[model samples]
Target: MKIVKSVLILILFLGIGATAWFYYPHYQIHKMKNDSMEVGKDLSRETYLDYYRQYSKQDIHHLAIGDSIIHGFGVDETENLVYKFSNQLGHEINKTVHYTNKGKNGMTSTGLNEMIKAGLLDEAIKTSDIITVNIGGNDVLKTAKKQDYYGAVKSFDTLQETFTKNLTEISMKIKEINPRATIVLLELYNPLPADHQFSDLADSLLPKWNVNIYEVAQQIPSSIVVQTTKVINSDNPQNLSQDGVHPNSAGYTAITTQILKQFSKEYRKEAV
Candidate 1:
């Protein structure tokens, strides 16, 4: 009887330890999110635009590429994030901002790399002063859907590895086409609601993928990673479209704001 009781106690302790390990990181993530919200609230579009007006160039040629987010899936043409970004950037700098959108509805990192390798985007890339890339979400979703939770988690390492390799090739191709063009890579945000079954898994794996993005950006000159996780998360259903997979108008606006903020920072850094 005592032996059975001792085994049960050990099992209970192990369960408690696992629970703590899981919940502790989530708790910290929650706190960090709240802090980020506070910081986001302080910066308005006007604030970023004002900074840009002081240091920005008089003209820009922006090229947008990647997946559905760049294609403005579930949103109208006018509500597209790239369109809004280009308009706002032009207005702020009092310049001509010509933009070309080459976004496909279901593009993956591998697809993008393949397209670039085929020289399909070479002309646009060569003429563009700015290029924005939004990819890897579809890649993650495809892997997650095809496997169990643990299986998906185990597969993320390989997914990220493949993504890193593809993205590096894509960046190199773009830079080879236009070394002067600045590449803006947007980090993927969790689209699952907090109470959703896959939310925790997404939250756990997304940062690892984003770290790959950041590391890739660091390798390529004139490239930067724009963080979207803080600005666009499952906390606000209104930010997402009916599909809950893509951003709504408001969400795109938020993303545009973040992108512009990065642009202003880059210009300021260059001016220094």
Candidate 2:
């Protein structure tokens, strides 16, 4: 009788331990996200534009849209894709490039469509020489809640359809607004390292989404999808930030290189 009682007690303790193990991270993530939204809420899009006007009195406008990657989420202004690319392009072309960023932390593809519909992106898009997008991460991220790879995969299946539709619509809208503006969509990377529990599934699923991004870019005029997985999120994830989700200094630098490469490719084609 005592032996059976001991086994039952052990099982109960294990169950409780497992529960705490999973939910603790989720709770922390929720808290951090809420705090970030609260902070970002006050800093409106117009504020960023006016700040740009103060520093650089130039007509060159480069608008960065989409999620936190585009927003430079866990990094300083210098370490963000927007500033790095803008600065490099300015130096390369001998033009003063004014950068405008409309990166939201928890944005999905649909959210981006809504933002465009609301005319939040109108002035920025119309004035932009180049428009960079980093979206669809949150769409897949919403599925990570299951903590079960199989379940997460299933969740991603549903999100894939809507993500494709919304992203296509977004590209069409951008083209309609400004046909001359080059649209560069950042490819998805597996933020979770290979050894991590959900890494394999994330890697497998991310590429599927990338194909959609590539296809959409191909269909849209003056648009290209920049690959990020091989550069930012590698086998060891060396370029990742401390959070293992966002990019570090090296990762952002890699991103800047890819963006310039795509532009160079077009410039060469045009010159030839």
Candidate 3:
């Protein structure tokens, strides 16, 4: 009788703790929004275009797709890479350049392929000049069997195959939708090291994952692969985030600059 009672109490405590962990961060954000101390602080622009004024409503250039990176999960809305890319491309192209970002948290390459198959990519491809994809991190982040860390590391071959197939399929679908659209595939970056908590499990597998992204990018035409691993690793990524998983404003800025440089070079070449 006593053992049963203790087990129930332990389960209740764990459930409470998990709830707190999940909601506390969001609660803090809400509190900040309501707090009068932050009035007139100007965290971000009121409109997306305010931060990316180089593009006009009629002459927008591209569309951005992928997961949390494009979503600006850790950064303010105006400081996202999509806006930075647009601002830089506008300068290089000598025309108003706009980009529509369609990013979600925890999106994987498999999910992207599914979304395309479901016609989610149709509208964006039809109207956009260029498309940039930044998926694959979550696909690589999947564990093989809950606690089977070693097994996950060993399954890179399978993961790589799936990633390649998905990228190829997405490229083909986009071409079919709009043959003139150029696609830019952004490579994966690992913020975790061997010494990091998740590293003993994922470190060996991550480099292989990144390499697979590079290989897959080579197989697609009209696609430019941009690498930002060095920039993300320049500082301890863990320190750059409020949560250990997402990058903060500074990290987003660094990554935005790295990608903007690449887009500038590519746009210049295309213009000439």
Instruction: Judging by lDDT against the true structure, name the best candidate.
Output: 1
Candidate 1: clashing pairs of residues: none
Candidates ranked by lDDT: 1, 2, 3
Candidate 1: minimum summed lDDT over ten consecutive residues — where?
263-272
Candidate achieving the largest TM-score: 1
lDDT of 1 by residue, 111-213 (tens): 9999999999999998898899999888877776788666767787788889899999998888888886778889889988999987887887676567667
TM-score of 1: 0.78
The better-scoring model by TM-score among 1 and 2 is: 1
Off by over 4 Å in 1: 1-57, 148-150, 266-272
Error of 3 at 22 (Å): 38
TM per model? Answer: 0.78, 0.74, 0.68
| Residue-wise C-alpha lDDT for candidate 2, range 1-272, written one tens digit per residue | 99999999999999998777545544543443243223233433222223334335455788999998999888899888889989987776666888988898989898999988888889888988678888988876666654555666777657888888998988888888888676778888887766787766565556566667776766664565676765876564767899888888778988888767655543211100
Write one digit per residue (lDDT tens) for candidate 3, span 221-266: 4455665665765255642576666667777767667666554433
What is the alpha-carbon lDDT of model 1 when measured against the actual structure?
0.78
Better of 1 and 3 by lDDT: 1
